[model samples]
Target: MRERLFAAAERVLAREGAAGLTNRAVTEEAGLAKGLLYSHFADLDDFVAQLVLDRFEAIAAEVAGLPERAGSGEVRENLTGAALALLGTNGPAVAAAALSRSAVAERVRQAWEGGAPGPGAVEEAMARYVEAEQRLGRMAAEVDGAMLALAITGTVHHLRMHGSALPDDNPELVRRLVAALVTVP
Candidate 1:
Protein backbone atom coordinates (compact mmCIF):
# COMPACT_ATOMS: atom_id res chain seq x y z
CA MET A 1 0.00 0.00 0.00
CA ARG A 2 2.82 2.36 0.89
CA GLU A 3 4.63 1.34 -2.25
CA ARG A 4 1.55 2.06 -4.29
CA LEU A 5 1.31 5.51 -2.80
CA PHE A 6 4.94 6.12 -3.56
CA ALA A 7 4.54 5.01 -7.13
CA ALA A 8 1.43 7.12 -7.54
CA ALA A 9 3.33 10.08 -6.18
CA GLU A 10 6.10 9.50 -8.67
CA ARG A 11 3.64 9.44 -11.51
CA VAL A 12 2.02 12.59 -10.19
CA LEU A 13 5.40 14.23 -9.97
CA ALA A 14 6.19 13.21 -13.50
CA ARG A 15 2.96 14.44 -15.04
CA GLU A 16 2.27 17.49 -12.87
CA GLY A 17 5.61 18.38 -11.29
CA ALA A 18 5.84 19.05 -7.57
CA ALA A 19 3.29 21.85 -7.67
CA GLY A 20 0.51 19.44 -8.53
CA LEU A 21 1.42 16.84 -5.97
CA THR A 22 -1.20 16.71 -3.23
CA ASN A 23 -2.45 13.98 -0.97
CA ARG A 24 -5.60 13.90 -3.05
CA ALA A 25 -3.63 13.68 -6.28
CA VAL A 26 -1.50 10.85 -4.97
CA THR A 27 -4.42 8.93 -3.56
CA GLU A 28 -6.49 9.39 -6.67
CA GLU A 29 -3.60 8.37 -8.84
CA ALA A 30 -3.14 5.27 -6.74
CA GLY A 31 -6.83 4.52 -7.19
CA LEU A 32 -7.27 4.49 -3.43
CA ALA A 33 -9.33 6.60 -1.05
CA LYS A 34 -8.08 10.13 -0.41
CA GLY A 35 -8.12 9.44 3.32
CA LEU A 36 -5.77 6.51 2.85
CA LEU A 37 -2.80 8.84 2.38
CA TYR A 38 -3.43 10.71 5.61
CA SER A 39 -3.81 7.39 7.37
CA HIS A 40 -0.34 6.38 6.20
CA PHE A 41 1.51 9.70 6.22
CA ALA A 42 1.38 12.74 8.45
CA ASP A 43 0.93 15.02 5.48
CA LEU A 44 2.17 15.81 2.00
CA ASP A 45 5.55 16.87 3.34
CA ASP A 46 6.11 13.61 5.14
CA PHE A 47 5.06 11.69 2.08
CA VAL A 48 7.40 13.69 -0.14
CA ALA A 49 10.36 13.21 2.18
CA GLN A 50 9.74 9.50 2.46
CA LEU A 51 9.46 9.27 -1.31
CA VAL A 52 12.82 10.98 -1.78
CA LEU A 53 14.54 8.92 0.88
CA ASP A 54 13.04 5.79 -0.57
CA ARG A 55 14.67 6.59 -3.88
CA PHE A 56 18.00 7.19 -2.19
CA GLU A 57 17.75 3.95 -0.29
CA ALA A 58 16.93 2.07 -3.46
CA ILE A 59 19.89 3.49 -5.36
CA ALA A 60 22.14 2.80 -2.42
CA ALA A 61 20.96 -0.80 -2.38
CA GLU A 62 21.55 -1.18 -6.10
CA VAL A 63 25.03 0.31 -5.94
CA ALA A 64 25.90 -1.69 -2.84
CA GLY A 65 26.60 -4.62 -5.10
CA LEU A 66 29.32 -2.76 -6.97
CA PRO A 67 32.10 -4.22 -4.86
CA GLU A 68 30.90 -7.72 -5.62
CA ARG A 69 31.09 -6.88 -9.32
CA ALA A 70 34.77 -6.06 -9.06
CA GLY A 71 37.29 -8.23 -10.91
CA SER A 72 34.59 -9.09 -13.45
CA GLY A 73 33.34 -6.68 -16.15
CA GLU A 74 35.43 -3.88 -17.59
CA VAL A 75 36.41 -1.46 -14.86
CA ARG A 76 35.09 1.47 -16.85
CA GLU A 77 31.83 -0.35 -17.51
CA ASN A 78 31.41 -1.33 -13.90
CA LEU A 79 31.99 2.17 -12.65
CA THR A 80 29.79 3.64 -15.34
CA GLY A 81 27.06 1.16 -14.56
CA ALA A 82 27.11 2.10 -10.90
CA ALA A 83 27.10 5.78 -11.76
CA LEU A 84 24.29 5.43 -14.30
CA ALA A 85 22.21 3.30 -11.97
CA LEU A 86 22.02 6.27 -9.63
CA LEU A 87 20.56 8.34 -12.45
CA GLY A 88 18.33 5.57 -13.76
CA THR A 89 15.72 6.16 -11.05
CA ASN A 90 13.29 9.11 -10.98
CA GLY A 91 15.86 11.01 -8.97
CA PRO A 92 15.36 14.46 -10.46
CA ALA A 93 11.60 14.52 -9.93
CA VAL A 94 11.98 13.26 -6.38
CA ALA A 95 14.64 15.87 -5.72
CA ALA A 96 12.46 18.61 -7.15
CA ALA A 97 9.65 17.53 -4.83
CA ALA A 98 11.91 17.70 -1.82
CA LEU A 99 13.34 21.05 -2.81
CA SER A 100 9.90 22.52 -3.43
CA ARG A 101 9.00 22.11 0.24
CA SER A 102 11.46 23.41 2.81
CA ALA A 103 10.21 21.13 5.57
CA VAL A 104 10.45 18.11 3.34
CA ALA A 105 13.92 19.18 2.31
CA GLU A 106 14.99 19.60 5.95
CA ARG A 107 13.50 16.29 6.94
CA VAL A 108 15.36 14.54 4.14
CA ARG A 109 18.58 16.31 5.12
CA GLN A 110 18.21 15.35 8.77
CA ALA A 111 17.52 11.77 7.85
CA TRP A 112 20.57 11.67 5.62
CA GLU A 113 22.68 13.29 8.33
CA GLY A 114 21.35 10.73 10.79
CA GLY A 115 23.04 7.99 8.73
CA ALA A 116 19.92 6.82 6.97
CA PRO A 117 20.81 5.43 3.54
CA GLY A 118 21.42 8.29 1.17
CA PRO A 119 24.07 9.70 -1.17
CA GLY A 120 26.79 9.02 1.37
CA ALA A 121 25.88 5.36 1.43
CA VAL A 122 26.17 5.21 -2.34
CA GLU A 123 29.52 7.01 -2.14
CA GLU A 124 30.83 4.53 0.39
CA ALA A 125 29.77 1.59 -1.74
CA MET A 126 31.48 3.18 -4.73
CA ALA A 127 34.66 3.71 -2.72
CA ARG A 128 34.64 0.10 -1.62
CA TYR A 129 34.06 -1.01 -5.19
CA VAL A 130 36.92 1.11 -6.45
CA GLU A 131 39.15 -0.26 -3.71
CA ALA A 132 38.18 -3.78 -4.71
CA GLU A 133 38.96 -2.99 -8.32
CA GLN A 134 42.29 -1.53 -7.32
CA ARG A 135 43.04 -4.73 -5.44
CA LEU A 136 42.37 -6.64 -8.63
CA GLY A 137 44.82 -4.42 -10.53
CA ARG A 138 42.01 -2.96 -12.69
CA MET A 139 42.34 0.61 -11.39
CA ALA A 140 45.39 2.76 -10.90
CA ALA A 141 47.30 1.92 -7.74
CA GLU A 142 47.84 5.60 -6.87
CA VAL A 143 44.23 6.63 -7.29
CA ASP A 144 42.30 7.50 -4.14
CA GLY A 145 39.21 5.31 -4.01
CA ALA A 146 37.36 7.57 -1.59
CA MET A 147 38.14 10.67 -3.59
CA LEU A 148 37.03 9.02 -6.81
CA ALA A 149 33.85 7.93 -5.14
CA LEU A 150 33.27 11.49 -3.98
CA ALA A 151 33.84 12.84 -7.46
CA ILE A 152 31.38 10.53 -9.17
CA THR A 153 28.69 10.63 -6.51
CA GLY A 154 29.04 14.38 -6.18
CA THR A 155 28.51 14.83 -9.90
CA VAL A 156 25.53 12.52 -9.81
CA HIS A 157 24.00 14.50 -6.97
CA HIS A 158 24.60 17.76 -8.78
CA LEU A 159 23.08 16.47 -11.97
CA ARG A 160 20.05 15.17 -10.14
CA MET A 161 19.56 18.42 -8.25
CA HIS A 162 20.01 20.60 -11.34
CA GLY A 163 18.72 18.23 -13.94
CA SER A 164 18.39 20.78 -16.69
CA ALA A 165 22.12 21.22 -17.23
CA LEU A 166 22.43 18.23 -19.54
CA PRO A 167 18.79 17.32 -19.93
CA ASP A 168 19.25 14.67 -22.56
CA ASP A 169 22.69 13.36 -21.62
CA ASN A 170 23.08 12.73 -17.92
CA PRO A 171 23.99 9.11 -18.42
CA GLU A 172 26.56 10.08 -21.01
CA LEU A 173 28.01 12.68 -18.68
CA VAL A 174 28.26 10.11 -15.90
CA ARG A 175 29.90 7.64 -18.23
CA ARG A 176 32.40 10.25 -19.36
CA LEU A 177 33.19 11.21 -15.80
CA VAL A 178 33.84 7.62 -14.85
CA ALA A 179 35.97 7.12 -17.94
CA ALA A 180 38.07 10.18 -17.18
CA LEU A 181 38.74 8.85 -13.69
CA VAL A 182 39.58 5.20 -14.46
CA THR A 183 41.44 3.60 -17.32
CA VAL A 184 40.31 0.30 -18.75
CA PRO A 185 43.80 -1.24 -18.74
Candidate 2:
Protein backbone atom coordinates (compact mmCIF):
# COMPACT_ATOMS: atom_id res chain seq x y z
CA MET A 1 0.00 0.00 0.00
CA ARG A 2 2.80 2.37 0.78
CA GLU A 3 4.49 1.54 -2.50
CA ARG A 4 1.24 2.24 -4.32
CA LEU A 5 0.92 5.60 -2.62
CA PHE A 6 4.55 6.44 -3.31
CA ALA A 7 4.22 5.52 -6.94
CA ALA A 8 1.06 7.60 -7.21
CA ALA A 9 2.83 10.55 -5.65
CA GLU A 10 5.70 10.12 -8.06
CA ARG A 11 3.35 10.19 -10.99
CA VAL A 12 1.63 13.33 -9.78
CA LEU A 13 4.95 14.98 -9.09
CA ALA A 14 6.34 14.02 -12.47
CA ARG A 15 3.35 15.14 -14.51
CA GLU A 16 2.12 18.15 -12.55
CA GLY A 17 5.14 19.42 -10.68
CA ALA A 18 5.09 20.21 -6.98
CA ALA A 19 2.47 22.92 -7.17
CA GLY A 20 -0.04 20.53 -8.61
CA LEU A 21 0.36 17.88 -5.94
CA THR A 22 -2.48 17.44 -3.46
CA ASN A 23 -3.99 14.71 -1.34
CA ARG A 24 -6.84 14.41 -3.75
CA ALA A 25 -4.53 14.14 -6.74
CA VAL A 26 -2.42 11.50 -5.09
CA THR A 27 -5.45 9.52 -4.00
CA GLU A 28 -6.96 9.70 -7.44
CA GLU A 29 -3.70 8.70 -9.03
CA ALA A 30 -3.35 5.83 -6.65
CA GLY A 31 -6.97 4.81 -7.24
CA LEU A 32 -7.46 4.48 -3.54
CA ALA A 33 -9.79 6.01 -1.03
CA LYS A 34 -8.76 9.47 0.04
CA GLY A 35 -8.76 8.41 3.66
CA LEU A 36 -5.95 5.99 2.94
CA LEU A 37 -3.53 8.87 2.62
CA TYR A 38 -4.52 10.35 5.96
CA SER A 39 -4.28 6.92 7.50
CA HIS A 40 -0.80 6.40 6.13
CA PHE A 41 0.53 9.91 6.65
CA ALA A 42 -0.13 12.82 8.97
CA ASP A 43 -0.53 15.28 6.14
CA LEU A 44 0.62 16.24 2.66
CA ASP A 45 3.84 17.54 4.12
CA ASP A 46 4.54 14.21 5.77
CA PHE A 47 3.74 12.39 2.59
CA VAL A 48 6.07 14.58 0.58
CA ALA A 49 8.80 14.22 3.13
CA GLN A 50 8.47 10.45 3.16
CA LEU A 51 8.42 10.35 -0.61
CA VAL A 52 11.74 12.13 -0.88
CA LEU A 53 13.22 10.26 2.05
CA ASP A 54 12.33 6.92 0.52
CA ARG A 55 14.27 7.75 -2.62
CA PHE A 56 17.29 8.95 -0.68
CA GLU A 57 17.25 5.85 1.48
CA ALA A 58 17.28 3.63 -1.58
CA ILE A 59 20.23 5.54 -3.00
CA ALA A 60 22.01 5.31 0.32
CA ALA A 61 21.48 1.58 0.44
CA GLU A 62 22.95 1.18 -3.03
CA VAL A 63 25.90 3.36 -2.07
CA ALA A 64 26.45 1.37 1.08
CA GLY A 65 27.54 -1.48 -1.17
CA LEU A 66 30.25 0.59 -2.81
CA PRO A 67 32.91 -0.46 -0.33
CA GLU A 68 32.45 -4.07 -1.44
CA ARG A 69 33.03 -3.04 -5.04
CA ALA A 70 36.19 -1.11 -4.20
CA GLY A 71 38.78 -3.23 -5.92
CA SER A 72 36.45 -5.04 -8.35
CA GLY A 73 36.31 -2.27 -10.96
CA GLU A 74 37.82 1.00 -12.03
CA VAL A 75 37.28 3.60 -9.31
CA ARG A 76 36.10 6.20 -11.80
CA GLU A 77 33.66 3.78 -13.39
CA ASN A 78 32.22 2.69 -10.08
CA LEU A 79 31.84 6.24 -8.81
CA THR A 80 30.31 7.33 -12.07
CA GLY A 81 27.86 4.46 -11.91
CA ALA A 82 26.80 5.48 -8.42
CA ALA A 83 26.44 9.13 -9.38
CA LEU A 84 24.49 8.29 -12.49
CA ALA A 85 22.16 5.95 -10.58
CA LEU A 86 21.33 8.82 -8.22
CA LEU A 87 20.76 11.38 -10.96
CA GLY A 88 18.83 8.98 -13.17
CA THR A 89 16.02 8.62 -10.68
CA ASN A 90 13.08 10.92 -9.94
CA GLY A 91 15.30 12.93 -7.64
CA PRO A 92 14.63 16.25 -9.32
CA ALA A 93 10.90 15.97 -8.86
CA VAL A 94 11.22 14.87 -5.25
CA ALA A 95 13.65 17.71 -4.55
CA ALA A 96 11.30 20.23 -6.14
CA ALA A 97 8.39 19.06 -4.03
CA ALA A 98 10.37 19.29 -0.83
CA LEU A 99 11.83 22.71 -1.64
CA SER A 100 8.64 24.30 -2.96
CA ARG A 101 6.59 23.53 0.13
CA SER A 102 7.64 25.03 3.44
CA ALA A 103 5.86 22.41 5.46
CA VAL A 104 7.50 19.65 3.48
CA ALA A 105 10.86 21.36 3.83
CA GLU A 106 10.34 21.56 7.57
CA ARG A 107 9.44 17.91 7.73
CA VAL A 108 12.57 16.98 5.81
CA ARG A 109 14.65 19.22 8.04
CA GLN A 110 13.21 17.56 11.11
CA ALA A 111 13.98 14.12 9.70
CA TRP A 112 17.57 15.12 8.99
CA GLU A 113 17.91 16.53 12.49
CA GLY A 114 16.47 13.33 13.89
CA GLY A 115 19.34 11.31 12.37
CA ALA A 116 17.81 10.46 9.06
CA PRO A 117 20.57 10.43 6.46
CA GLY A 118 20.58 13.05 3.76
CA PRO A 119 23.11 13.70 1.06
CA GLY A 120 25.72 13.35 3.79
CA ALA A 121 25.10 9.61 3.88
CA VAL A 122 25.90 9.32 0.21
CA GLU A 123 29.05 11.36 0.67
CA GLU A 124 30.11 9.15 3.54
CA ALA A 125 29.50 6.04 1.46
CA MET A 126 31.59 7.46 -1.33
CA ALA A 127 34.32 8.36 1.12
CA ARG A 128 34.39 4.82 2.43
CA TYR A 129 34.68 3.51 -1.10
CA VAL A 130 37.52 5.89 -1.87
CA GLU A 131 39.29 4.93 1.32
CA ALA A 132 39.05 1.28 0.33
CA GLU A 133 40.55 2.05 -3.08
CA GLN A 134 43.34 4.04 -1.47
CA ARG A 135 44.11 0.99 0.67
CA LEU A 136 44.45 -0.98 -2.55
CA GLY A 137 46.83 1.65 -4.02
CA ARG A 138 44.32 2.54 -6.73
CA MET A 139 43.79 6.10 -5.53
CA ALA A 140 46.29 8.81 -4.57
CA ALA A 141 47.45 8.46 -1.00
CA GLU A 142 47.35 12.21 -0.54
CA VAL A 143 43.73 12.56 -1.62
CA ASP A 144 41.14 13.30 1.01
CA GLY A 145 38.39 10.75 0.52
CA ALA A 146 35.79 12.81 2.32
CA MET A 147 36.57 15.89 0.27
CA LEU A 148 36.39 13.98 -2.98
CA ALA A 149 33.09 12.44 -1.92
CA LEU A 150 31.74 15.89 -1.12
CA ALA A 151 32.80 17.22 -4.51
CA ILE A 152 31.17 14.35 -6.40
CA THR A 153 27.91 14.45 -4.42
CA GLY A 154 27.84 18.23 -4.61
CA THR A 155 28.18 18.15 -8.36
CA VAL A 156 25.42 15.52 -8.51
CA HIS A 157 23.12 17.71 -6.44
CA HIS A 158 23.87 20.67 -8.69
CA LEU A 159 23.06 18.64 -11.76
CA ARG A 160 19.86 17.32 -10.24
CA MET A 161 18.75 20.85 -9.35
CA HIS A 162 19.16 22.09 -12.89
CA GLY A 163 17.25 18.98 -14.11
CA SER A 164 16.35 18.90 -17.77
CA ALA A 165 17.52 22.46 -18.18
CA LEU A 166 21.08 21.19 -18.29
CA PRO A 167 22.61 19.24 -21.10
CA ASP A 168 22.74 15.45 -20.81
CA ASP A 169 26.52 15.32 -20.70
CA ASN A 170 26.87 15.33 -16.91
CA PRO A 171 27.79 11.62 -16.65
CA GLU A 172 30.97 12.16 -18.64
CA LEU A 173 31.79 15.20 -16.56
CA VAL A 174 31.34 13.21 -13.38
CA ARG A 175 33.50 10.42 -14.79
CA ARG A 176 36.30 12.85 -15.54
CA LEU A 177 36.01 14.42 -12.11
CA VAL A 178 36.28 11.02 -10.42
CA ALA A 179 39.20 10.05 -12.62
CA ALA A 180 41.03 13.22 -11.67
CA LEU A 181 40.39 12.63 -8.00
CA VAL A 182 41.55 9.01 -8.01
CA THR A 183 44.60 9.54 -10.20
CA VAL A 184 47.72 8.06 -8.58
CA PRO A 185 51.07 9.79 -8.69
lDDT of each: 0.87, 0.83
Q: 27-112 in candidate 1: lDDT tens per residue?
A: 99999998999898898899899988888888889889999999997888888888877875677887888999999999999999
In candidate 2, which residue ranges exceed 4 Å CA deviation?
164-173, 176-185
Off by over 4 Å in 1: none
Error of 2 at 161 (Å): 2.9
Per-candidate TM-scores read 0.95, 0.90
Residue pairs with clashing backbones, model 2 = none
- In the range 1-185, model 2's lDDT, one tens digit per residue, is 88899999889988999898899999999999988999989988888899888877788877779988988877788888888767656678778888999988898888878878678888888899989999998888888999888888988887776675544676776777677666753
Show how many residue pairs clash in every candidate, following the order shown: 0, 0
Enumerate residue pairs that collide in model 1: none
Q: Which candidate wins on TM-score?
A: 1
Tell me, by lDDT, which candidate is best: 1
